[model samples]
Each structure stands twice: as structure tokens, then as C-alpha cells.
Target: MRRSSDLSPEIAEEAAWWRDAVFYQVYVRSFADSNGDGVGDLEGIRSRLGYLELLGVDALWLTPFYRSPMADHGYDVADPRDVDPLFGDLAAFDRLVADAHEHNIRVTVDLVPNHSSDLHEWFQEALHAGPGSMERARYVFREGRGFDGSQPPNNWTSVFGGPAWTRVPDGQWYLHLFAPEQPDLNWEHPEVRADLEQTLRFWLDRGVDGFRIDVAHGMAKPEGLPDMDIRPQAPGVLSDDVHDPRFDNDGVHEIHRMIRKVLDGYPGTMAVGEIWVKDDERFAAYVRPDELHLGFNFRLVQAGFDADAVRSAIEHSLAAVAPTGTPATWTLSNHDVVRHVTRYGGGAPGEQRARAMTLVELALPGVIYLYNGEELGLPNVELPDWALQDPTWERSGHTERGRDGCRVPIPWEGTSPPFGFSTAVNTWLPQPNEWDHLTAEAQLEDPGSMLSLYREALEHRKSNAGFAGEELEWYGAPAGCFAFRRKGGGLICALNTSGASVPLPPGKVLLSSGPMDGDQLPPDTAVWLV
Candidate 1:
């Protein structure tokens, strides 16, 4: 096994660093805390560079840490160019970028282009400037419906629940696909496009490696703010339903093309979009040559733990990017969604399946993103209702528990709450006491731990030539089992999703998600044979 720094000079010379890369998604607030303020910050991330390097990741895809009022954590950006005081100043970010590069790790920050915080200077000015003013033109402000302008401008509801259009004091209604504090921008407005382009250049000029565009499919709306034919079954979840007129509109391609033009000016810097369009044809459009370098297709994330479901997800995801020749991004968990550990089942079974899926995911030929705390076999924290902070909790009228479960602070080195996440006893989101056994500190010493499994797998993926290539050949296997061979690599990854044990193919066992019975793979387990 080889470290990321030991990659062959030739392999590292590829112009696109993100292709076939393993990126670690750092949800800034939950990653680490150097300030003892019970919140993670840029300094904390900088201090943990060595840990990430040891884990063998090629890059860091950090979620937003920009200046905001915490309306939706950092997703609602008040200032794109400035760092939030809670995270650190611009100097701190510079230091983080400098140190991260020293570890041979690339840094990609989140870009929330779909909307801006209502507290943003521009949005505030728009509010005071009144409707139809140039200042108001930056956002999607419109007139209301009904005789007396009493109803919302449109029938579209927010992903976070309630009406998508919020009525302002001056009688005009503004579109906010998310929370009311986050007003959707008018992409058709030249000023809005210019401002976002400037924001991209600002971060790129600051030495940030790239950006992960938030709501990439959502910048542009149809000619008319038309009402969708469907309603979201669940509030705040990115709907995969194609009838969602509010997202993945044809106009969004132009916005992406403009963003791509800005990115093209800065060579080697990539732009990845968080696209939720289920249609492969539409999803592929965002990653067209003149658009994003990669688009996040969530088929795998939404799949069940069954073998057929996983296979279908992977097949669809691969087909989505086959035409473009770009790397297909694979992710099992992120800041949103239930952690894979919990999603698979819960205790032993869940951890086993999570580990199995990790092998399956990493084995695929593409860029893999591992969410923070995932390598530690961390499950979602079931927080008390009083501890919930996700905007959806209130927006959904408390009917939906929201995403706070997966955003808990990571357990670094200790055996109790906060672990080594912070010196302060109280973290922004409370850590579960049962996480003592799963801390990085504890796992590092256990050979059978998920941390060790990930370290070994990543190192192997980096060092071994067998993990190369984009083609996967399916091998005939028993029912509920999936066995696929790497096109040129002689590497076979097999998963037994059945009730009974399955016989292994002829090869040396390189890695197994769990203890195996000689050459037999038990149910809910995966193995890499070479």
C-alpha cells in the first residue's frame, strides 16, 4: 500500500486532479474545533492536516464556512468573499490552504450560488430599494397573486417547507427555494451572474483549489415562475421527481456554462455540482464540456442496502457520465442524508454493511467522497428534540426530524461526549456517549476497525495498479450476490447480500469488510480479491 504523496509522478501529472480522486467532505462545523468554542473552525481543520494525510485522501471538499447568520448553517451566504467570524478571518483560511497544500492535499470550498442570505448587503439593499429597482433585480423578487396581492407570488413550496415565495414589507414577494432568509437569485439578471462569477474568482484567486456548487441545478427558473405539477412528499429533501419545475430547468445549463467559463480561466481548478436530477440525460447536461467538471448524481445515496438496488444505482450513475468521459462522483453519505452506518441497519449489521459498501464504492472507477466521521464507523446521532438545529425541524412543523442526526461533531481522541472534537464540553450538536468505542483514537489501535479498513483500502487504491480503469465486468454469481471484475486490473470485488454464505472466486483475498469463514463470504459483507 502506498500513501497519496507516493503516487507516481506520471500519475500525478494528470491535468484534472479530481478525476479518480478520493475527496474527504469536511462539514466545517462538525470536523474539528481549535477555538474551544464548541464549534469547528478553519484553524481546527488546519491542525488536523496530518490526520487526513495519514488517511490517504487526495483532497478536501469543505462545506461552507462563509459569513452568515446560520439560517441554514453556512449554506446561506451573507458574504462570499469573507470568512465568517465564527470560522476565522481570511488569514486563517489562507493559512489552512497553505498547510493543506503542504500535505499534498487539494482544498475545494462549497459555493452556494443558488441564493444569498437575506442579511447579505445586496439583499438588504434590495429590500430597502423597493421592488423593480436595479438593486432588487439581483434576486427573484416578483408580484403576488390574487386581487389584493394577499397570496404568495406562486404556488411553489420551499424544499424546507412552507411557501417558496415570501412576502416582503413593501408588498412584493421574493422567491426562496429554501428558507425565507435565503432568497433565490435571478440568474437572468446580469448583475447576479457577474457577482457569482466574481465570487468564484475571489476564492480561486485566494488559492482555493476548486468549488462544490450547492444546488447546481437550481440557479435558473423557467421563463415564468410556473407552478410545479407536483408537490414534494418530504420537506427539505432534494426531490428526484422530474416534474419539479423549480429545479433542473433548461435555463440552468446557461448558468453552469457561465460558471464553467470562469473556471476555464483558472486552469486545474474544478467545479463539481450537487445535482439531484434523476434523469441521466438531464444530469449529464450539467457536466457537459462547457459546464461542470463533475455533477453529483445521488442514485447510490438513495438506494437501499440490497445488491440489485446498488447495482442499478451504479449502472445508472455510470451511464450518466459515459458520454462526457468525465469521472462519475460516488458518495455514500454527506452533511445531509442518514449516515450509511445507520442507513445500512444500526449495530453490528449496519457497520458491516457500511464497511462492505465502502469497499464497493471505492472499488468503482471514479472520484469517491467520504464524509467526515464516516471512516470512524460513526452512526447518526439521534438528538433530543431540544438539541435539533436544522431549519427543516421547524419548517416541517417538527414533523420531520431533519439532518442534525448526521451532523454531530466527530469523535477524535476521547471516550466521551465531544470526544476530542473540542475542549468545550458542549458541542453545537451533542455527541452520543456510545460513540466512545468508535473514536479515531480507539479505532487506530484496533486492527479490525473501520478506520484501519479505510486506511488500508485507500492506500491500496493509491498504490495498486489493479484499481485503475473505468470499466467493470459483471461475473455470474449466486442470487443476492454481486461479483464484478475490473476491466484490465484482475481485481474482483464481491458482495454477498444473501442469507447464506457464498463461495469466493479464485484469487487472493486482499480485503474483507468483516471476518470471513475461510473462503466463504457471509451475508452483508464485501471483499476484494486479487
Candidate 2:
């Protein structure tokens, strides 16, 4: 195996870069506005590099900034080679990369290889040529009759809602596993694979360190268009049929192999995939050494505060990937889900739960991602129906309400209008009502705040060199309390998930999520001992 240090001084610095590394996920639209255009831009990110560096994170994962029409919030790329004009052009992006490197922070951009926007030049050319045309072959288009011409060619449904197939004016249908505006690429096509490889090469040549592939498992489907039975309760909801045989095919291995071939030429480059599988064995298949370097573990994000449940999730995830030589990436919150603080707590009690959970996540092996504004203990903002812009909510009958609450702009300054994110009179998304209370500026001044706790915890992890490569060992603890030890580091981490005090073992407390004197453990708190 080639080490990162073997390639170059820079590559060496990135090698094993993710081990014990902290990453901050920046949702481009809500980060910061450079041109006062009411939208965040690449230059805004460059301006904030010092802020991120001071926060103690090792890297930044900037969510899709590629050229797009803003459908699905930049996931629908119109061009892979250029940054969206709304977010700044290629020169601005290059400067952002340079600035991030100056801070010793690695940058990973979101790569949407599964699909492209309907407005993409390739998709436009394919539509004009129709079926059987060379350009049309790059996408999945089928011509056939269905039941009474009213039924779709297959029973597959779009992730947003309704049937996945949309009819063209030419009397044929093209498959789109996501929104209609985001068409799924035909990965089986050699031309499609070649084109995607070129896209990867485009960024690598420009000095990108890695990519975070979106909906990577959805890239392939069963060759035969199979029908899935409709469920009784939510008869039309798309995710109800998620487990259908046609959803994620085994042929994804071939796709991974192709991606691996492209990445092999660029040593030290990493790729992380967002796979939604629940089973550990199946999920681990996507993260073999020859495949993706890391895959997001969604089980931890969905698990409640039960100690048994979290213990099982950690054990299963570790066992599944340990043999494959693939590292795991853990995230509790992102732009796609409800904020962790809100999910864990509906009120003040939930805030305590969020702080406890944060400690547990930080102690886990591999890279940990902290969503923007998470350090400030921000809760989900309540957005009115009229203010919602997520397509998933519009198409899914509002059952899920999409992810609008969590995508609200981050509040940096307490007294500034629009929380100092934009100087424009009207920002894109409405600022949360409690911005003054939750702003980073306010939290930074409070010694007992979650933001300060996060800073102390992260600093402890960085200073303890023994914690990086140490093996994790589970220890017995009381109910609602999860305890684990890292043997090499002589460190023990205990998290209290309940609302009552728990007994503490003999050891000096290195850090605590709540008030701690010598040995008493507070309710809904966490303690790290050495």
C-alpha cells in the first residue's frame, strides 16, 4: 500500500488525514455571502477560513458548489468543470482552495455522479436526438407500452414521489430515481462511465484532495425493470418501496471498480460515498480498500439515546469495516435531516441530550463530521409552509416536510441583521427567530455554553496523541450510560443519556459536557477521564 507521505510533502500531510480528523460540513447557500447577493459564495468560504481554523476542525466538506440551476440545491449539476456563477466562478473556487490549504485544512467538494440536471448540455443534446441516437444512449430511456398506457414502464418510484419514469414528447420515458429535474445517469453505459471519469480527473488536475459522492448507491439498478407492490398505509410515498429488488443492484461493485481505476492514478486522493443501507454487511461492501475510502454511517444518526442501541450500532459498524481495510465516517446531523439538538430534545431537556450525544460521537473511531451551527447547540427552526422551498416536501405530500428547518442560515453575529450572513435586505432563507440567543458570538462569550464545551473536547482529542490509533474497548456502565475506553490513550469516555446522576469511577476528569467538580456525574452529561 502506498502511503500519503510517499507521494509528496503535501500528499504525506493528507495521508491518514481523516483518522481522528474533525470536518465541518458547509451548506453553500447558507454559509456566507461575499457579493451581498443574498447567497453564500466561494469567496465567502475563503473569508471564513480563519474562523474554521480557530474552531479546531481539520477539514471542510463544502457541499455542491458546481454549476446548477439550484434545483435540489446544487445536486443537479449542469456542468462539472465550472463553479456556479451565483457562487462565484472558477477563479474564486481556486482561491478558496488556496486559502484553505494555507490554513492546513483539506477541502473535499461534493461530487454528484449519480445524475445531472435536466438543463445540462448533455441531457439537452440527448433529448433532442431522441431514442436510438448516440447521445440518447448515455441516459436510460425506454420505449414500451404499459397497462392501458396509464401505468409507468416499471413500478420504481422517484425518491421525491410518484413514478420514477417521466414521459418525453417523443412518447418514451426516461428514468430518474430522484426529482424529475435530476435525471439518473445510465451507469451501465461505457460512455457515461468515461465521462464521469473525466469529471473526476478535472478536479484532481486542479488540486482537489477528494470527493464526497452523493447518492452513490443509487447509481445502479437491476437490468430488468421490476414491479414493486404498493404499500397499504402511504400508498404513493416513494421511500415505501425503497427495499424493492430494483432499488440498488449488486452491479454497484462494477461501478466502484471503475471509480477505483480512475482514482488509482491520483495517489492519496480519497472518496466517500453516502449509502443508506441499514445492514452493516451490505453497507461495508461499498467501502473496501479498492472502493471508497469512507462511507457515511447513517445508523448512528437514526439511533435514539438508548445505551444498548448505540453499543450495538458501534459494534456492528466496527466489525463490518475492520476486515475490509476501510475506515468509516460518522455524522449525527447534516443538511438532509433535522438538527441533532432538535431531534434529541424538543425543549431544554433535549439540549442536555444533544450535549451528551456530541461527546459520544467524538469518541468514536474514524472521521467525525460536525454540521454547521451544531457547536452552538442550535435547534431546528420552524418554517412556515409558504417559506418552504424543498421539492421533496412539495412532492411527498408534506409528510416528511423535507429538510428546510435544518438548512436555515447560520447565525454568526447576535445583533447584525440576517445574523451577519448577508448584507442584502432580503436573504434567501429566513433567519431563525432565536438568532440572537443562538448566534456563535453569544455562545463564544459564555463559558458554560455548548460551543465552549466543543472547543475543549476537540482540543483534548488533538493534544492526546495516544488517542488517534488506539483500539476502542467497551466497558460496563449503568443503564442510560455508555462507557468505553481507549487502551493506548488511557482514556475512558462515559456519556449519561438519562436525567439522573450516575456513579463515576476513579479517575481525573479531563473534560465534561456539564458542571463537574471531582467525581459527581450530572444528569444528561458526559465525562472524559484519564
Best by lDDT: 1
TM-score of each: 0.96, 0.94
Models, CA RMSD each: 3.5, 2.9
List, residue by residue over 1-530, the lDDT tens digit for candidate 2: 34333487676655567766798999999988989988888898888898788789988888999889988989899998889999999899888888898998888889988899999998899999988998887778887566545556777777777778888988778888878898888887898888888888888777777888888777787767777666542322222224665455678777877787777677767788887776777777888777887887776777777777777777777776887867667787888878878887657877887887788778777788889888888788888888788888877788657777888887888575588888886778788656787787888878888888888788878887536554688777888777888767767788777667888866777777777634667777888787
The C-alpha stretches of model 1 lying farther than 4 A from their native spots are 1-13, 232-236
**Candidate lDDT values, in order:** 0.89, 0.79
Clashes of each: 1, 3
For model 1, residues 333-414, the per-residue Cα lDDT tens digits are 9988899889889888999899999999989998999999999999988899999999898998998888999999999987
Model 1 Cα RMSD, 1 decimal = 3.5
**Distance from true position, residue 392, model 2, in Å?**
1.0
The local distance difference test score of model 1 is 0.89
Candidate 2 — worst ten consecutive residues by lDDT sum? 233-242
